[model samples]
Target chain A: MNEREFLKQYDKTAFDQPIFSVDNVVFTVANGGLEVLLVQRAEHPFKGHWGLPGGFVDLQKDLTLDDTALRKIREKAGVEPDYIEQLETLGSSQRDPRDWSITTVFTALISKQRCVPTDENVSSANWFPVTTLSELQLAFDHLEIIERALKRLKNRATYSLVPCALLGETFTLAELQHVHELILGKKLEAKAFRRRVENSEQFEETGGMTSGRGRPAAYYRLRPGAMGFEFVRSV
Target chain B: MNEREFLKQYDKTAFDQPIFSVDNVVFTVANGGLEVLLVQRAEHPFKGHWGLPGGFVDLQKDLTLDDTALRKIREKAGVEPDYIEQLETLGSSQRDPRDWSITTVFTALISKQRCVPTDENVSSANWFPVTTLSELQLAFDHLEIIERALKRLKNRATYSLVPCALLGETFTLAELQHVHELILGKKLEAKAFRRRVENSEQFEETGGMTSGRGRPAAYYRLRPGAMGFEFVRSV
Candidate 1:
């Protein structure tokens, strides 16, 4: 059948409408472990409980899901994430209370920078250790979202240089390894880790030194074009 | 503000309602390259042009988006892909002709299998080599979706066992390497490839062999519970 003939029989208004929202699972390495940014909801529908920083995607101002996430972060926390990627999409019949909605989940990795007090919608914003996340009462399916992001983060740290977002612009090799260990929950042999990093072609020595109360170490930064490099690794 | 005060000021009805849809990129390796399953649209919007097999979410019957993708694939093609993963979510407000819709894209990898004749709603179903996909006029933003999925497949073949889905249930090491090369578009050193595969711990030797004209080669299958293994390789 020709496309024009098919179009003549098609009806566009017959499809059901569903709402779409964006949620961000922002992670940062702080306090010697992996931490997640959570906000205390001040409104109904699981009010007062903790939830990931997110809101309804504003199509009026946002161009993509990535823009929605960045806008939400900027509006609620007054800061931007270091790295953001689409994690997953959750669309169930009853996942939302307000409507039959589809939420596109995004994972935003950032350094240990606190969310500035910018909005009254959230009573409090804090970073909690992911290991003890079970103790807190979270709103909606946020706990599941965080778990999925955590799994992705752990797996991605081995291949992509995304985890570098959890470190400052310039960091020592030890600091980089520490961020990796916190996410993967395992210590890496220093020699092997260094060798892998050197072979990855993702990092470049910055010719700077770490400022700390110890023997100063050389610093390095991720090469500009290597952010999307997929280095194979046996994580 | 306390939680109660915040709830009093919050308004849920102010959020804009957006429609949701699911799109599937069913991929297979055929004709010596990667191929994507495309169905001719028998309805309007892009009547006659080819598009990814998908439909509006059937929240009335399906429980989740994953279920929606599976149900659509079953209804349209009469076959289930071997490995399916959430790829990305596209929500650009005016992406749809009927309404503001957000479509979650899924990538379903399968071995070279033919799509059975099924739904009459689709004018036709065919597989096209991804390399020449640009020549075909695709409906909606399907061309962009396929490109995203193709990039993901190429990168994923280096780390995860997903590329194995493009091969038969059991395959020889040489065949497995061929699948990887086809997807990655590069040749791998045989010795290095074997060493990396053995180190992955994701595959095990099966007590069977492939009967070919040259010589019988031992068969290997993905180790139990290793389909989700994240093997590291420097792709």
Candidate 2:
């Protein structure tokens, strides 16, 4: 094309831009503990290493980048984030060794019981306690992802009914405390925590007793319209 | 650079990864209300338009993506995110008209008193009331940026004390509610919200009271050691 035509024919809409990708940190609560789900990679580069289950975006695929990531989770892990949100973007000049890859890290809170190991790209899958994950060699920048995910979850526990996301329909408050303590990495003031949680109006007593033989704790779960963001301005 | 050399010596960081950029949403509580800080772009594409304060990342120039972003916030808008964090990344096939730019959005809450607009690239900087922002025209995906920033801040409100980032070093609980009402888009039930907030121990009730108020609201801010990302867990 001539310079005149080229100057006037710049199609911004059709301009060639770089590609985008997504990664996920899928977490679940199992055996009254907090754990992160990881898979053993079968491909080269980081082959034979365990990592967070995620893959590239098929440029030819027919979906948005965010949707593609969630679909990949379902495609590989057989479990989707019951609740998913974008965490951060990891886009250093050389974050990946292949092509220019821009990754939007998404955090997925899913049910631990429903997960099954079933992906061709993966050798095996399992959940590891957050505290005990250092022993497992992780691929890419996954260790950093776990640390950030844990931080976000821990911060939310004190003020929100966050642990409920990892639980089934019915659970005792004691079970909730166990999850919180694990995430918080310490025991909490039982009476103080109980009073505060019971006062939020975010949870209900469920009017049912615990299943165990010990202290019969009150069963509770999230109340309707209660599982979302609420910005509390500090003065 | 020969094919044999390329095969024999693998450069681990050789792929084309989309560069990550961060757009900051810095808000402050001023003039009896909540307001967002914005900058006028001086460069091409969105030149002279009001946009969220942000810029491209010189990844090698900074250690971490968030660090690069925080630097850009001051460079572009002359402001800092007191409540700085990685909110989300916007990376569609064509979000940027220039190149493949996958931007991670960061929202910082600070007392407006701490910041002032002073940069040549930023033509005019000002805080627009959060309530009336919808009526103004914001460049790029800024409208969407504000929406997401508000949502995340609001979502974290009911459960976290991070919002204290928006307040002055010393202020009353009623002052906090004003910031909340501005962001939440509705007046909150004072009695319940107050009770819930006080229980979190996010703030200390300094022996002070509102000068001109009914029943002298109690003063509070993010509790010193009581606040941290250590407990924040992600998916």
Measured against the native two-chain assembly using Cα atoms, what DockQ does each of the candidate structures obtain, in the order listed? Answer: 0.40, 0.17
Question: Best candidate per lDDT, number?
Answer: 1
For all predictions in the order shown, the interface RMSD in Å is: 5.1, 6.8
Off by over 4 Å in 2: A1-21, A28-35, A42-47, A78-83, A88-103, A109-119, A124-132, A150-235, B1-19, B43-48, B97-101, B154-235
Candidate with top TM-score is 1
| Model 1 C-alpha lDDT per residue in residues A120-162, reported as the tens digit of each score | 6444778889989999999988999999899999789876678
Highest DockQ, which number?
Answer: 1
CA shift of A221, model 2, Å:
12
List the global CA lDDT of all models.
0.80, 0.69
Query: What share of the reference contacts survives in each candidate?
Result: 0.51, 0.22
Q: How would you encode candidate 2's per-residue C-alpha lDDT over B147-179 as one tens digit per residue?
A: 888888887665566676777787777777777
